[model samples]
Target chain A: MLRDALLIAGKDLRLELRSRVALNQVLPFALLVLVLFAFALDPDRGLLARATPGLYWVAVLFSALLALQRSLSVESADGNRDALRLSGLDPAGIFLGKVLAVATQLAVLEVLLGVGVAVLYTTRITGWVLLAVTCVVATASIAAAGTLFGVVAAGLRVRETLLPLLLLPVLAPVLIGATRAFEAALAGSPSEGWPWVGLMGVFASLYIVAGVFGFGPLLEES
Target chain B: MTTEAHRQDIDSTGSNGTRVLGIAALIAMAALALFGLVLSPADANQGEVVRILYVHVPSATVAYIGCFLTTIGSAVYLWRRSRWWELVAYASAEIATVFTSIVLVTGMIWGRPTWGVYWVWDARLTSTAMLLLLLLGYLAVRRLPADHEVRTRRAAIVGLLLVPNVIIVRQSVQWWRTLHQKPTLLANGVGAKIEGLMLFSLFVGFIAIGLVFAWLLIHRFRLAWLEDQLDEAGLDVAIAERRAEGAAS
Candidate 1:
């Protein structure tokens, strides 16, 4: 299963690297979101700084949506879905591989966004460890949930709109937990942030297990 | 079966059992309105605003029941591929969404008079709102045009996910609320004392709402079954027409 996962993950990442869609489109779109938040909230009054954690995660969430759509669209075209089903690979491995690819993309986005928040919002992060842990756990949670729903929405004509409708509500806990954790880390309160990390961990594991089991049937359906 | 007889069979999604259940629900609902509106005394603190609790609390309970039923139906459908369980899941989810909406609106109405606002980030309200959105997602998936089997499988996955989603939402919202230390309006809203008549009225509300839920579920399931039959009949007609055209050519 692990070998199959790596193979699929490598294939997706290679496709992404060759395509450069993430670098050219999703990254700029995420940064644009940061800039848009600055415009929406006046930066001079320190409101933007206070809301940096939430704004950053919201941007990540939106970008994750695009990334998930892209990930699903990769197989959605050219009968790749059918080919993959007949590829003699385990369905659970495919699920984890897709999750890994998305999480890797999200992690890179997070690093860039972290820099963007630091520069654009002039936010100082005191708890680096807490900040890093939150990103890893929260990104895993988002990617696992997003990948599961991505396939669910993949074969539908209204998939573009339906994916978000089906996914965002389920990810509400992630947004809440990640934002709170980021707020704590940025505010130099590591103790307060740890619990939120725990919540994110729980969410990540729950969805990962769910995706592993649920993906087989969903893959066949899509 | 003859097409005419099949048409007649699918004409009405009703039976004697459902008629009896429907009549019982109507009677129970009428009694609930009478006891809840007239017999129940005003709360010492909340006064008239407290009356909404008759519908609000019962609706919330029924909504949870709907959620539970959907989970069971989804699980059984996935395990056994039973169309009956799928229809049960679909019907219960729609009803749950309706009841959850009622819970939200009534909670807001009660909140306005009691808490000076129509909304609050109280844990219950926030989680209930989240659940409504989640159910909407499930319904949205069900509405997508697809092969019937594909659609059912997709919806079942969403349905099964609801349990964990609800638990996570509730827990995270509770933590979100407590972390901020906002004054909990919900705690004060329902903390008022309930004596004999009000208690009895609330009990009547439960019976009324539960019966209404059962009645809706039966009717909705039958309607879905009829829809499936119609789709099959339509497919048969199309296939027959195509065959006739091929023969003529």
Candidate 2:
């Protein structure tokens, strides 16, 4: 399973490297959200700065939808899904591989968005450790959920319209927890953020286990 | 013969018992409204507006029952692949969404008269809102085109997934709300002192709502079965057309 996971991850990552979809498309979309949020909210009132963590997370959540869709859509074409099924790889491996690959892309998306907020929203990171850890944990949580839900929406004719509706509500806990954690961390009371991090970790692990155990039957459909 | 018997049991039209449940619900609601709205004494705090509690609380409890039923239906459908269980899950989710919406709207109405605001970030209210959204998503997934029984399998998985996720959403929302600078007005609105007719009224509300839920579930299940028949007929037509075209070609 681990070997297959690595192979799948490598293949997806190589696809991203060759195609540059994340760098070319989703990253800029995240930045555009930041820019748009700045326009919608008063930038000088200190409210935007205070709310930067949450707005950033929301942007990341929306962009993650696009990444998750691509994660599955890639396999939908050129007989790739059939090849996957016939390859005799464990479904759990394919599931994890997709999560890992999406997480990697989202990690980059978060960093770029992180820098954009610092510049555009005038947000300062007082507790770097808390912020860093929240980014990692929340990204994984989003990726796990996004990948699981992506498959749920994958084969449907209305997949593009369906994936966000199915996924966004489930990821609310992540958004709430991670946003709260970032708020606490940016407020310099890093202690207050740890519990939210724990919440994110719990959410992430639950979804990882869900994807592993739940993917068996789901994979056959695609 | 047993499979045929089971199929007949499920596929049969609505029964006389459904009428009984419907009548029981109306009677219970009339009793609850009388006692809660007129017979009960005014509260020292919020007065008559507090009577909304009877309907609102029952909406929440029965909604939770709907959630529980859906979770069970989702599990059994997954394990047994029974058409009955899938329909049960689908119907329960729709009923749950309706009751949950009632909880939100009625709570908002109660809030305005009492708290002078129509909304608050109270944990229970917020969580119910999330539950409603999740239920809508489940219903949306169920509406997707039927191919390979895919809708049932996927929706059952989502319904099952929702059970655990709701718990997590509840816990996280509760924790998140605590840090808010503004506290929810009437946070513990319903748990305050109550006795005599008010308490009994709540009981009547429960019976009323539970009966209504049963009535809705039965009719909704029959509707879903009818839908399944339509889908099967539609698929057969498409297949026959394809066969005719292929033969002509």
Candidate 3:
């Protein structure tokens, strides 16, 4: 399963490697959002610095939405879905592959956005250990949940609008968990971030398991 | 009667019998409103405005029940591939959404009189708002245009999501308690805090709302089942038309 997942993930990565849609469009969108957020909050004030964690996650979420849409759109075109089904690869492997590819893309995006917050919002990154752990867990949660809903929404005409509505409310807990953890790390209380990390871990596991079980049926539904 | 006949009879019997329950609910609401407004003494602390709890508590309870039903129906639908389960989930989610909306509106209206603010990021209220959003998502997925099977399968997945969300929303309230009161009703039940007439009024509110929910669920289930039959009939007609066209050619 892991080997099949890796093969699928490699294909997705190679596709993005060739296209760079995520790198050129989504990452810059994330950065631009950081700048816009700073402007909205008055860059000179310390308010932007304090709210950086929340704004940072919001940016990641929006860009993650874009990347998810793009990833599924790629599959929807040119009989790629039928091709996948015909290949006889495990559906759970495909799901895990999708999650891995999206998670990898998001991990890169989160790193760049983290730098953007540091640079634009002038908020220094302390508590690197806890901060990295929070980002890892949070990104996995978002990627797993996004891929599940993305495929669920991918086949419908209303998907463009429906994906965000369906995905966002469900991801609310992830947002809260990640933001709170980031806030703790930023406030120099890295010890306080553990419970929120646990929350994210649980949230991530729930979706990953759901994606594995539900994706095969969902993939066949359309 | 055969077992299948017996089951069908019970369903109809249950649904038809609830008509009386609906009228009973109507009477209960009137009495609830009256007793809550006049007979029940005002709180020494919260004043006459405390009357809203008679409505608000029941709204929250019914909404939670709706969520519970949706998740159960969703699970069964996925497992059994049953349209009955899908109909139940769809109807229950819509009812849950309405009840949750009432909870939000009533909570806000009641908050203004008591807390001096129309809204606060309190734990219970915040979680209730999240519940409403989750239900709205479920309803949106259901309303999306797709094949009956496609939509049902997708909506079932979305429906199953509410269980995890309910837990998270509640945990969030406890993890960061702000303005909202903690779980008060669970400790020794309603008999502990609310006495006599006030408790009686609250009980009436529950029966009224519970009966209304039952009434809505019955109608909605029937409507959804009819929709499925209509959809299949339409497909049959279209297929026949194609066949006739091919024969004419």
Query: Which one wins on lDDT?
Result: 1
* Candidate 2's DockQ: 0.65
Instruction: Report RMSD for candidate 1.
Output: 1.4
Considering only chain B, report the TM-score of model 3.
0.84
> Per-residue lDDT for B199 in model 1?
89
| Over 4 Å off, model 2 | B1-12, B181-184, B233-249
Docking verdict class for candidate 3: medium
- Each candidate's TM vs. the true structure? 0.97, 0.92, 0.92
Candidate 1 per-residue lDDT, tens place, B132-157, comes to 99999999888778988888999999
Instruction: Give model 1's share of reference contacts.
Output: 0.79
Candidate 3 residue spans exceeding 4 A from truth? B1-15, B177-192, B238-249
Q: Give lDDT: candidate 2, residue B92.
A: 88
Residue by residue across B1-249, what tens digits does model 3's lDDT show? 595884564364246466777788788888887888989888766777778878888988989999999999999988999788889999989988898998888878878877789887666777888888888888888888887778888889989878787788667555655313555422332234677888887888888788788887887787777677668877999999999999999
* C-alpha lDDT values of all predictions: 0.91, 0.86, 0.84
- The superposed Cα distance between candidate 2 and the true structure at residue B30, in angstroms, equals 2.1
Worst 10 residues of 2 chain A by lDDT: A213-222
Give the TM-score ranking, best first.
Answer: 1, 2, 3
Where is the poorest 10-residue window by lDDT in model 1 chain B?
B183-192
- The C-alpha RMSD in Å for every predicted model, in order, reads 1.4, 3.3, 4.0
- The 10 consecutive residues of candidate 2 chain B with the worst lDDT sum are B180-189
For candidate 2, the docking band is: medium
Scoring each candidate complex against the real one, what DockQ results?
0.79, 0.65, 0.65
